[model samples]
Target: MNTLYFAYPGELETPTGGYGYDRKIIAGLEDLGWQVELVPLGAGFPFPAAETLSQAQTVLEGLPAGAQLVVDGLAFGVMPEAASLACGRLDLVALVHHPLCRETGLSEDEASGLFESERNALGHARHVIVTSHATATQVADLFGVAEERITIVLPGTEKQDFAARGSSGKLKLLSVGTVVRRKGYDLLFAALDGLRECDWHLDIVGGLDADPGCHAALLQQLSGLGLTDRVTFKGAVAPQDLSGFYRQADVFVLASRYEGYGMAYTEALAHGLPVIGSGGGAVADTLPDGAAIYCGTEDTGKLRSALKLLMTNESKRLDMSAAARRAAEALPDWRDAAAQFAVALGGVRR
Candidate 1:
């Protein structure tokens, strides 16, 4: 049997959302009768830069001739040596959540430079898979790669048991993902500031990653705005408990500036929770028409209006809730994702 290696240099069982995409892809591949090797590399901040690069190089060197290697774009993007090693290795491919270099809040010149480097690095792959068409277009445009060279595989939510449960006394609002600036927890706090009088509580479930300064700043902003009591931060809950949280939430919101693919948005819809996501990026792709309200940007007034409409109008909420559930049911499973992966890699070794 042919072997495939899925490489992610991080804690294998960590609950961080960043690692989920790679894990899911690996599982999908495995289910399709492929002999999969999951190679977990580093596990800390600053990510053992020099040592990891050397170790990754060693791992790539060890792959059998014609074996396929699937690298997480987040880790692979920085390791130029690993890219070189991959070039020599058999049939290298990449699964990019989004180009790391295209992240929000970077200066245009800096973004442009990083984009160029990422385009070149991604070009090294025999094939590229992105989570959304939004990301695919960005990569194709930036890298000048043909659409045929890339494939879009939307992330899938592992099916969860959704027992019938009544909502908590307060109108519960939930947001999951990293506590980073791009996740827009700050905008969420600002929106909460305006809805202080409403009988609602907000829960943010995500871990702090890469930047502790942003985490501290978020806490300070929450305190300064007097939202500390109303907004709860449950840092990294287990997967089993996540469904309970989703069940309790009356609505789910992703206040992100952008998403390569908003998996949480889909997960919320799967649980029958109406979503309020910003309009651009992958938000439109995730939320079906009328299943969620789409805000243009961070206008607290706009968010406030949407929140009031959803909260006060019970009929509208229930309508969107049904629509969301239907949308979730319509999504393709992981097997479909893997089939697409196989198609993309058809020209390369099996």
Candidate 2:
């Protein structure tokens, strides 16, 4: 039987997109009859403590020689030394969702450090897997990895029933993502500030606990703008519960600064909700034109204009919603993505 070792940071069940992709791909691999071993590393990743790094080193060093190993970029990007050591002992592959240094809110020095470390680690890998073509291009251009060395396996979206929006007089806008600096919740709030004159209600569905300070700042912003009454923070919802939220909402939006692969945007399209988001990173690749209103990461004025246009014009909203459904239909399923992932692994094994 074919065997593979999957190494990643934190629990496999985490609600983030990277974790979600990992979980799905693992199941898919198992279904394809591969003997997959799960290796959970230290939790302090992307900026691990010294002890955490030591623990990761010990774990990776213990892998049997010639074993095929796939490392998640979150942890692997910061461990050039560990990766280099492991590479000599095993067939190593790096599954990068996006370049770690490209995350928003990093200082120049920190970004540079991460870039150098990640580039070094990737150089030792036999093959690299990314979730989007944009990421594939980024790694080639910035990290100097050859295009042939990288494989793009886009995230899959489930086929779901179209959203049945409520007939409520107010427009319902839903935004799903963790309350982090990169998600651009602050920019979203600023964009919505001027749209108070319109009849609308927004539900921010994401984990607030991930960043308590950011959550507190968002709450303060809501209160300052007297928007507490119209905006609701639903926190993170279970997978089963998310469908209901999509069913009730009229529109979906997220002003993310960057996305390795905007799974949330795809989910919105799957639900047939008109989307408004930044045209950064892999978002443009995932979301087709005419289906979403694109704005720059920092362009609150443009976002406000898009929101206003969607809110006031029912025909336009319906047209975009239909376009979103059509786009979702054209997206690849998890099975297809799994097959692609398996093919990539086969290449590394050869």
Query: Model-by-model lDDT, in order?
Result: 0.76, 0.89
Best by TM-score: 2
Which 10-residue window in model 2 sums to the lowest lDDT? 161-170
Tens-digit lDDT string for candidate 1 (211-264): 688889998998899878888888888766878889888989878887888888
Local error of candidate 2 at residue 110 (angstroms): 1.3
What TM-score does prediction 1 earn? 0.91
TM per prediction:
0.91, 0.97
lDDT of 2: 0.89
